[model samples]
Target: MATGTVEHVKFRNRDMYWDIAADLHFPPGFDESKTYPAIVVAHPIGSCKEQTSGNVYAPALAEAGNVVIAFDASFQGASGGEPRFLEDPAQRVQDFSRVVDYLVTLPYVDADRIGVLGICGGGGYTLAAAKTEKRFKVVASVTGANFGRLQREMAGQNGGVIQALSTIGQQRTAEARGEQSAVNGFLPETAEAAKQTGDIDIIEAFEYYRTDRGQAEHGCVLFEAAHGTAVLGWDAFYLAEELLDQPLLIVIGDKDKQGAFGAYRDGHEIYERAASADKTLLEIDGASHYDLYDRPNGAGEALKTIVPFFNDKL
Candidate 1:
């Protein structure tokens, strides 16, 4: 059992026009009168707070003597937004800042000591957010991936950028003409289906999101088809070389196969591109991209480094 207490909370995303759902984790001996360093744990693409962010990292960070908040991005989970299942990178990046806005309002939160940790796709968005959001004093990513790059590369192999854009254009027109927008699943419906494809990332993703391992009612891996264009064009580290100057830590699996969805390459790329004066890259041997989500050899190993890094930096 966990030692910390969790508080269900909601806050407004001013730019996205939605109410964001989140969970706040307080340390075991939390004192209302004392300010504490805080961390914002961002969930992966197609995942909700109840999975890794809330279930794994939040409690662990709280137990390490920090206040941690795990949140569902707008348009997903319990968050409010129209055109449900939209996966806009711009909106996702903004979500972090919105979370910061809420965090600073808490009397027990030390606004100057706030940091952020993003996993998988959320890791990419965290980099983007920290680039411009100066309030985030420190930044870290676990198996971070640029979703836009993922979409573009996948589109390249499937058809082509032009073809993918044309499809999204047509979908948007159809929706404008009163047709229901098409929704697409992130992975195969079942772990068995994913295994049949012979892709380790997909198989692991299906196992995590579809099974009791990390499943949650709101962890639906679906997105609006028309929004593909937005994701395809966006780059999480667009201005990172020029603007991401905060202290940074990047953790990735050394054994990641650099598959279609692998973050191994991205992790190193960001480590090279980020202009942060203080930065460190850690690769966990014998772990894969999804392993960092919850597996002991993955997320657990990462915490050994993460808890100390945040404690020192924040």
Candidate 2:
């Protein structure tokens, strides 16, 4: 596989440890005199920088005259975090912001022109980062999820907010009493089952991430079944207004039913409602959730819109 320069890097804050592994891509005939804009590509949950989605998106952004840095989230992939397998939405957002901090220190990067692109859960993180960090001048969320909505549905009507909290409390109590907390969240494992979600992209996601097309790098995410942290955790909507001052781009596949693109619709609405006058939403017809991962046409469609979005805003 073709690769970029793998930099073993560290970014520190008193409260957290970030073991950042990034592949920096600068196109051929790179120039040092000019400072390039940057796109920090965030991997989906349970994913690493090597996944095809990240692989394609980062390089594509680089090829389009921007610098790209794709890195793993703190707890998963080759990144560092304790109590392994613990995933928190708030921390994930912080991870993205920290990446911005790291990027600003680089001489070749135009700190004022930084942007972020998140796929799947990464998309949500991208929104969260934009909401919280003023440094991200432009932000994009691809086939994303609204974790709050996801939690509400997963908990079910019978298990309301109180019930959900109670259940997680019980699990934590059990863990405190020497019992191990079991992780329960997972994507459909089979192609047929994935298709049954009424999402063609989900089925394709099953084919790519579950198979060799993207599987060699990392395993799928472990569902937080007991606590449903995605819901109980921080809400991106809480910080939505902060992003109003910046440019935002949201890309969704019309056929994506796996919730990535669907979630983008909500995010787009939020951005539209924001006072920021520089936001654009593009919905690609016939594209599914997985299509944006690596296929030339799908990725092509995304870049066609994305390159121009960044070009105008960045």
Candidate 3:
């Protein structure tokens, strides 16, 4: 049987204590024979360790002769935080770095050969973290979204400025009156209500993230009031040109409709621009955006490329 442990651990930042929802997995054959490489897995936005596919990927990699630590982001999952679901890109990057800090302290981990896997929004955070965190010897991002671009579009789309303002204003009003403003969940319980909004991917996202398949009640979207605090002048794609002199791998679904029609072009262009000579990109045909998470070939295709990349790099 595989060995695992869950604990409430705190990492220091300046002087404040940052609590983490941390899980350490030890494969059946795990032994203290020698130091083994370890990888940190980050879940998607609005997702916890149990909500997203991290639960599958983390242990899979750990079983492949690498120790894996899958943890909930600071404000989400079972982690401690106030005004739940608040997402900060800078802080999220720090979370990955902090996880590395935790891993290095273990006698079983090889601190020199560390790697990280970030899925979806977590992928973007992985890239962002790698930009400065040299501890990550290898970085792999799956179906990553550029957070800054997402925020900019949300603030500038058709009537976006007004819509964002109105939404945030309404949420703040409720909060000021000592009310817990309702936030967005994965689904609305019915297909008709799911289609009311133009978020094309929500239909499928709701099917998985809201149903028993991938559902986790803790993974709720924040209200607009929390948007300002979470997004605050943040952008994930600031420096796509920097070279880390390490291996890099990126995976995206060729059929991801959430990024507009045939949006795989953006991911391809990123792979082309990466300065790492050891960099590789895989575009899976006939796969949807959400398919990369829990779909049949999703985790398989991802591990097929990711494990080897980490093996070669770390």
Candidate 4:
């Protein structure tokens, strides 16, 4: 059950669709006159605010006496934008900044003490936002998704991801001529099919997005095949440590699956690369990349560490 009041909201970003829909999680027993710290929580890539991060993180953080807000990425979930399910990292990172702009307006929020927290791809985007948007004084990421790894591989940089460029090129042409059907499905349609892919990451994604365990209607995000083209040039880790000056905290499971592509990217790499003098990396024993999303032991265990990180640092 939710521990606080939730207000459905609409805000704006500079994109073609300016209205961004979001859920603001007010603190339990919130006092309008009293100032409180604030945190902007972001959902993973291809996910809406109601998924694990946006659904669970806000309430837990709000109950800890801070105001938290989770919003859908533009063009995905409830946010307004064209090219639905478009996965543009650059614009997604800016969403956090716009959220910060709104948070600073609340009478009860301490703008100077604001922090940021993101899960999976949101974590990666949150880091990108922090690099340039200094409004976020502290930063924390759980199960950071390095989706761009696939982007790099497809560009032939990884070498192991052979001929991905050609495959993507074919799909891109189909997409350019408005062949939406040829490049729409982003995930396996069913758990059984996901399991048949012989990919552990897809199997785990199926465990959450395709089942009663953690499924949400908006979590099933589809995208254009041309999406991979943009990703191929972007690097989530580029100049990360030098560009990010904020105190950073990254947490992930020790047992996160290492597939050719997936959430298996290391949190320690970001922690090590971060320029912050005050950075920490937390590893949960026996937890996987998907486990950090939730599994009773996952989300619950993560908050035990996350809450304190915010309290002490923010």
Candidate 5:
């Protein structure tokens, strides 16, 4: 059993409603005098912290005897930002750094031992954050995707990117004219509809977000279409080989084949590109991409590797 308390907390440039809404998990015992390592868990893009990081990853890391924080990014979930679902890769990276900054002020935290764990797009953002943020001593990602690149690849699939970009351009034009940005859903409203789209990623994502399996009533798939262009300029591995000298670990599942993910282990290129000789690439057998997110068995196996990696490196 985990021995810690969880609390809903928020802090930012200083406001409650617009702050980074988060959950703080403390280690197994109460000790105000002792300093402890801290970890930050970033949720997938288009996902709220409550689903993945706040509930699953953060608790696991906290179970391993460290403080953990899981937070919603700007313009999503409980957090507040204008033009909701504005997935600015650069801003998301900044969110990670700011979280670290907040942690630095905590008297009980050992700032030097701080670490970060990001899931999916959050994983990419985490990599971007670690690029220049020296405060994160170590970094790890689960089922990490370079969302910017992923967006481009998805948009470009079937030669739709050009059209998508045109639409994005129009939205930008509307915004410049002080018109409300166009809002649209990125996922189907139901699992069946998503499956009918013949897009495997959409099908799986819908299962997680639109159904009872992983759905959060307050969750959203509607985002500003204009933001899609922002992803075109981002890469998860940005400066990774040169600046990511700190230890790194990437965990992913291996069952996908012929689907959008294919059978390739996640973050393979990242591992190859990272300059850190100490980096590790772990792939859980018999698990698909979504499995790594919350499958009880897969999550257990992932922790076997994750808990040890952070304990040793951090």
Candidate 6:
């Protein structure tokens, strides 16, 4: 059901000295002689371009008559980076602007009409990136999560923050002393195991990322344990009330089970705090957090608003 052509491409993440793997979806009847508005889609934490970002949103947006690029983060997927699966918040935020830098260099892309759409953790970084990176004239997020808050809360639930920090500090010291760095798994090994935990979020996440439903080899659910300190200290919405002036749209599932991941609360908080003159907070009833990732009822319903928002803003 695609109405566009997709091209595999690679671009340099200048700051990180790595090449980012990306998929560009060009609208039907794309003409290089003519310029088009572009959108950069950021994937979730521990995810790659092939998941929701490229598989769902990118093509949908392209079919709506825009150019969209979904790229792997510097340290994940097909992109180049060291200490694989290191989820550094600062680099994640910079990846959006780095994508914009690539888009502007293309003769077919309108530099002034570029925008960004992020899913889950990517949504949090998109908002943070758009705050100072003014190249993105419009910004949108689906099931956006503030990773710092999510990590801190999860740490508090598993153990005290002090204990979590102590563990991370010890691991870092050990790694610096020529020991192998520890890695953390994002979810259980299988859907059945995830279901046994009785956490709806983990259960659905496993159904999506760990199974054929949305699995890709590059979408591994692991991260370096030593990178926890960066994630813990980062805040996606830091100073959003002061600097986030771009037109913004935030979409979240009304049925999101708010436990360790609080995209529901994060969506509303950013909507309330963003200083943009044009901002909207959309709550999709009957949808869960993972539902918006690839489900027809979730992502399909979201595109109803998303397509028009980009059309009007970009």
TM-score of 1: 0.97
Q: What lDDT score is found at residue 11 in candidate 5? A: 84
lDDT by residue for model 6 (108-214), tens? 99999999999999999899999999999999999999999898888886467768888899999999999998889989887689989887688899899877899
Residues 112-135, candidate 1: write the lDDT tens digits.
Answer: 999999999999999999999999
Ranking by TM-score: 1, 6, 5, 4, 2, 3
lDDT of 2 by residue, 41-116 (tens): 9887667788854578887787777878888777677777755555678778788777887888889899989988
State, as a TM-score between 0 and 1, how close model 5 is to the true structure: 0.92
Error of 4 at 306 (Å): 0.4
Please write out the lDDT profile of model 3 over residues 1-314, one tens digit for every residue.
34543333455544235577867766657776678998888888778787544567776777677887888888677776665666777678888887887888889799998998888778778877887888988888887766655555657768775676577777778788998755654346676776776554566667767678787776664432545534636656556577444578889887775553222544565577666678888888777667778776766777787877777788
User: Which portions of model 5 miss their true places by more than 4 Å?
Assistant: 14-18, 157-159, 197-200, 261-266
Off by over 4 Å in 2: 1-10, 31-34, 192-202, 224-227, 257-261
Q: Is candidate 4 or candidate 6 better by TM-score?
A: 6
Compared with the true structure, model 4 gives a TM-score of 0.90
State the lDDT of candidate 5 residue by residue for 1-314, as single tens digits. Answer: 24868878878864323678888898887486888999999988778887877778888899888889998898888887887888888778888887887888889899999999998778878888888998999999888888777777667677677788888998898889998777778777776788798855667788888777788844676677877787776776877879987899988776654346432333787888888778888877887667777887666788889998888888
Model 1 segments beyond 4 Å from truth? Answer: 13-16, 157-159
RMSD values for the candidates in order, in angstroms, are 1.6, 3.0, 3.2, 2.6, 2.5, 1.7
Candidate 1 residue pairs that clash: none
